[model samples]
Target: MFRNFGKRTEKAPDADTVVPLWPQNGSAAEAEPSAEDRKLSAFLELKSRMHEALIERLNLAVIDKVEPEELRREVASLVGDVLAEENNPLRADEFRRLVDELIDEVLGLGPLEPLLADPGVNDILVNGHKTVFVERAGVLEQTGVRFRDEKHLLRIIDKVVSRVGRRVDESNPWVDARLEDGSRVNAIIRPCAIDGPSLSIRKFSRDPLTLEKLVAGYALNAQAAAFLQALVEARMNILISGGTGSGKTTMLNAISASIDPRSRIVTIEDAAELQLQQAHVVRLETRPPNPAGGGAVSQRDLVRNALRMRPDRIIVGEVRGAESFDMLQAMNTGHDGSMTTVHANSARDALGRIEQMVSMIGMELPLPAIRAQIASGLQIIVQLARLADGQRRVVSISELTGLEGDVITMQDIFIFRRLGKAADGSIAGEFIPTGIRPQCTALLEAAGARFDRAMFLPEEA
Candidate 1:
């Protein structure tokens, strides 16, 4: 049943079927350029010219109103015509790459588009026009990505802030904004940024991490996760404390999933990054003052408003200022299941920070009064840390046992014991129970929650 067209033989591939002139990894890794490199360089030069010509041909002011697919097709047609007129020798793959880059340049953040799309990249740090760095798996690495010049970088920054209804100029040298996908961005330009404009993007995951994922990643042990769930379900106020980039928000999001869906939860934030999953929830974000220095809204204002909304639980993204006092008042006065995060190195430091922030509001409260409030309002403090090896883990979980002679007392219920660094450079640690049952066990039991006693027993070494 077989028909032979000819003898099967190997043949030299066509030019279009050959490997792309650009590197396979999308980075120019080689120090020396081959003959094909010259062709690639020439094509890049031509693409730059075509990019400028295409920009001039389109009315950018109205570009956002156009359908993306339609705009891409129109741009492709124009690019094809230009390619034909130039009569440059380009392989089919290279021609398609040129079109995609041109489209990104016109409609997106030019040099950052590809980086933003990469799922492996956790943070994008743009130091200036020529330098770009990315944090992958908590390790910072430089990339080959670059802009045409400083002006081009400035354009990209403006494009980002403008979409969020914010601005960055000589007068306003810095701005905080969020991308459509919810990545938190902070940009500081000239004057403030001595060298040049610097942008930091804390990339948000498309699918927020859940408690199970955090356990699977060895961020915490199963016992701790179960205990935390019980605490949330029992309406215990929790303060997630950690340093910058220490996964405090991530932990907050994971634990918030345990909140009762029927309860009305209100979340406040500076840039609005919390993704709470409860059915009945309201989100609020603080607003910066206008150019004339009016119409500003603070987290304290949002917190005050959230109180009147009859929220069963209040969640603040991070308490950086006097809002800490309002947040604690809410927690103490009937909002038993409230949760928030603070930047601190340990559970005790977290309490100190809250005290300092409370004093900032000029409440004129004595230190003992503030400590009493914190101890009575907050039941659990979950401390997180990013280890030297770039692994983020729940380093400690403590229970505030109330004030001991004017000093707030806390006992660790669970702790991470570091053995040392592993061969591959990862910090090796064991999340072990401290064998001390939380004083809130009676309160949780009164709320109809049950837990295994052995969960609090320390492991045998």
Candidate 2:
């Protein structure tokens, strides 16, 4: 028979509501309280009984215990007054490391974690968790580390994106963040990810690569160095070209070293890698959106911003898109001596890439107008390529001489030819001159630059 009055019956504790904290996916440790606290204590007696009953009735411990420091006071607080009996026992250092442990176990094998430690890895890429790669010596190589699974990868993705105040989920599953080491990180989760979660990190060197070290590394020869120095002194607009592991940026840095100390330089980059040592140098980096997904800064924004700051030279780290047009326009207007690097297989390809990028500027400018922009605004294109032995060499030095009808005209001022190698199997080549000094030598002279022919000797090579 049913009772007329409303009645309530006691409900059983949930057996499956025991969701894990921290990782929300994986691992932790349990530690006993102090012997004094654990032995001969009514509190310990009460907890042990509750634990037994809860485990028997609900198939879960009333309190899944952790060492205070490891559990973290703030996170432990989320468990509610049910854990009010616990002491705040975490020491600062232990808490931090335990947090790291939680992150590592949670994150599993997200590649960016290790990359933050690798000094050589300048960049990292993830088509997805199963496919991860890094850039070394300007070349890409896949790494052995990987996430245990997609969820394992997501935890780390959460920590990183959250730190940078970005997000990744079903709705908006892509984000960019910077590591503690200042490496740039980009991540994409499902929906946007055709595969699993994809990630990329452009790692940073703790110390900037210097010009002297570059010469020692055989990236630039003496004859090439002197000529490049002369170009910088002359304020010639220079574009460096190379394939994906090429030393374009390294070469650009060495060449930029030749600029007179008196002039001001503004360096703009998506990842801020350049390290110029001039007294008046100003460096600007682009910013990705915040966690709430607002406040983004771009290359073109920096370029336009640099103009108002009165830059003597605007050095862009690399030109990958429509920024080529803005760069060329800046070069033509007044930013002569501006230097930048571009991805290309050869000098000709760099030109073509620029031509294509200028098209991306969304203008219907005729090929001739673009060609004219290239010829008039740019002065030289120096090409770099990585050899089999992993050496980055300055292979070609060409000048944008002028225009031929609608086509841009270029002339080689200096070229590197592969002479036979020495007995040691080390690379031996002539960074020989083409016997045509750049016309800009006269311009440099007018600017009070002092130079002589012997200054182009290969001693520095």
Candidate 3:
């Protein structure tokens, strides 16, 4: 049973009638508690009686047919009757809050609904039943929201996984899924999660940031943006490399907007999160095996299949496995404008990672052959990083020129030069030209997407 409600001196004028707490003119006080706060308070009080006979009397099917206002009224009446019978007094605001909370518990994700609705929140981290943390603008802060207990948290996790036709249990204690809104979700429970059931949600932006907006935010300069746009328009094979939470996908999505609308683009991912606005786009997502561990579809299989689909551009969400070989094959074999992301610290490391992934195929291909394939397929690498102050920036832009013996030769056209940290602890840096004009400039010119050669010249020059 839940704990008793704390006593408050203020009481309702009548048990049957509930009035609005805000002023008639619709003015609210600065210190007034939010609707979510009030609902949380009310939920605690009614937690014990949630499954009582009175609550069961309200038919869920009938409730679904009722309008929101009408449903609230019906729920308010029921809550009022329950409170009156208990001989407990509550204010008008408290009565309304109880009704709202009951509805959320029945129809929504309960305590998480408010956090999910907040646009400012970037990520939701549920450590356990009592602790919740939210990332706002890349910085994490503890939130007051909590579940009733471990059981309640598990119930919510089960609800999320089930919606995607997935399950989590003792045998399969971890699951990865995406919300209907495209937010990514990862959950771990029981023995796997030593502390408690852990859930992490990497929320997607409802309104994705554009390249212009990214430039305005100092993620990259105008010259760099123009160069990338030209490269994309010229159908260059590009790979974006970045660390975890470094905005690689966001950068890819923004650059992908430059793709010609008439071109058929196929995007493959483990979970479909890319919001391609193009009219001719096919999104493919990989599937995990069932409880029996059969019928699994991998990204490698999708990449190989996408080639047969006559794709003008193949945009892999990321290449972390044997799919790197297939992606390279597609790019090398008439699939220009292909793009993908990789987890690496720098441009040189990005090539090394791809080589390692290719080696994972267990084939005895010579090192020089692997290097040649990467050199021929990939034209550019855009490396991004999240700075100390939680700001993401395009750190470097390099072109894979060609293979020199066993090594893949590369040259940076642009790089971010870090000056120092500011008083506010933000990293002060400037994106500067590396003074090396890429060999791809000829290709861009041939495609009528040429830019000023001075854009690649050093600032001093």
Candidate 4:
């Protein structure tokens, strides 16, 4: 079922013919390329040639029908024969690395395969073909990974978007897609990018962190974790607010574990990143307009549709635009256990942003009316922040105490007080209760949730 698969006769560059891995565009300010960098660039070039030869020898029509393992063995066999014909001297480890990377080039995300496999790498930021950075343990560090050239980088980006039924080109220069493993990806090319193609991938973890794990990591104290779990068990409407990379999504995933397994849940998102572990759940993702600017489904549309799906809980991955209005309506009408995240600096700011988003729907509603909707719908606002030291912690958990006249009033049930910085540049903070008993305590108790009055008491200094 293959074409004439035989040894490649093309001459390969001698192992000693390594060239400097200078910036392809010849940036003057970049440091002198190192010997190791030169070797890597040479290997990349060699791999590119080998890939072309392999494709020429294989039957492209039936390649997609082959099983992954069988295809890998066939590709490896062909690559080995080609390498032997070229007679380039390589150590066993280097030869194996070359073969593995070739497989990635053929089936995976090319240079990003290794990074995506790294569990510690939480985020991948590709500025262009040559510069790649990864966030490990909440800290950004540059990696030595590089693509062959701009064309190669564009090919990889196209491959990623096409797999998700999306496209990126001059007409549609930007697209949001996800990897097979559900990693969130956003790619923007030429013209709009100014420099070159830019891609950002937020890697999704297979085993999502639970509330117990977050508490162990000191993201929040045990008392606060217990309280949040109780809030979820009570089916309270929760709004998680945080800035970018502040662990808002992680917090949402962890808290969602408390949702009853019997409950019918519906989750909506633009790129579909929420990893809710419930058994009975339907996930809905918004679709961008096609190349002809038709058949686009917005988040607001999914939220409205989810309401009719008879869901016990509606979990919106985020409320960025007019969807916030429909989400609030869902929470107020009947979906009491609904939850969502928002981009904001504080809990109060989160409310203000939601009000603005709701007004954007052009309902022409009064400010107090909007505030009243928010006050009745949302019960808890959990604020998260990533400290300067790269520690993400819940800064506060405030409860909506209903609107006092036209103003929506809230009381902080728990807070993290930043005492000072340590000598090692680490942040020193205390997760302390604000000693305010939330108005929802009765509601939680009525729902048979464990309510600990002592956990809400302020600590004695």
TM-score on alpha carbons, each prediction? 0.88, 0.66, 0.86, 0.90
Better of 3 and 4 by lDDT: 4
User: In model 2, what are the clashing residue pairs, if there are any?
Assistant: 122-203, 138-245, 165-291, 166-291, 222-461
Computed on alpha carbons, the lDDT of every model, listed in order, comes to 0.88, 0.70, 0.87, 0.89
* Candidate 3 lDDT score at position 126: 98
Off by over 4 Å in 3: 1-42, 51-74, 84-89
> Candidate 1 on 1-461: residue-level lDDT in tens?
11222333276444465434443453555656777656555665676788888988888899889998888888878888887887865677877788888888888888789999999999999998878999999999999777766887898899998987888998889999988877899999999999899999999888899999999999998889989999999999999999999999999999999998999999998887888887898988888888998899999999999999999999999999999999999988999999999999998899989999999998699889988999999999999999888889999999999888998899999999999888998888899998898888988888876567688998631
Q: Residue-wise lDDT of candidate 3 within 93-205, one digit each (tens)?
A: 86665666677776666778889889999889999987999998778999988887798889889988888888899999999888887888999999999989999998888
Poorly placed runs, candidate 4 (over 4 Å)? 1-35, 59-72, 87-89
User: For residue 420, what is the lDDT in candidate 1?
Assistant: 89
Candidate 1 at 267: error in angstroms? 0.9
Ranking by TM-score: 4, 1, 3, 2
Top candidate on TM-score is: 4
Q: Rank the candidates by lDDT, best first.
A: 4, 1, 3, 2
Candidate 1 residue pairs in backbone clash: none
Cα deviation at 338, candidate 3, in Å, is 1.2
Candidate 3 global TM-score: 0.86
RMSD of each: 12.5, 13.2, 10.5, 9.3
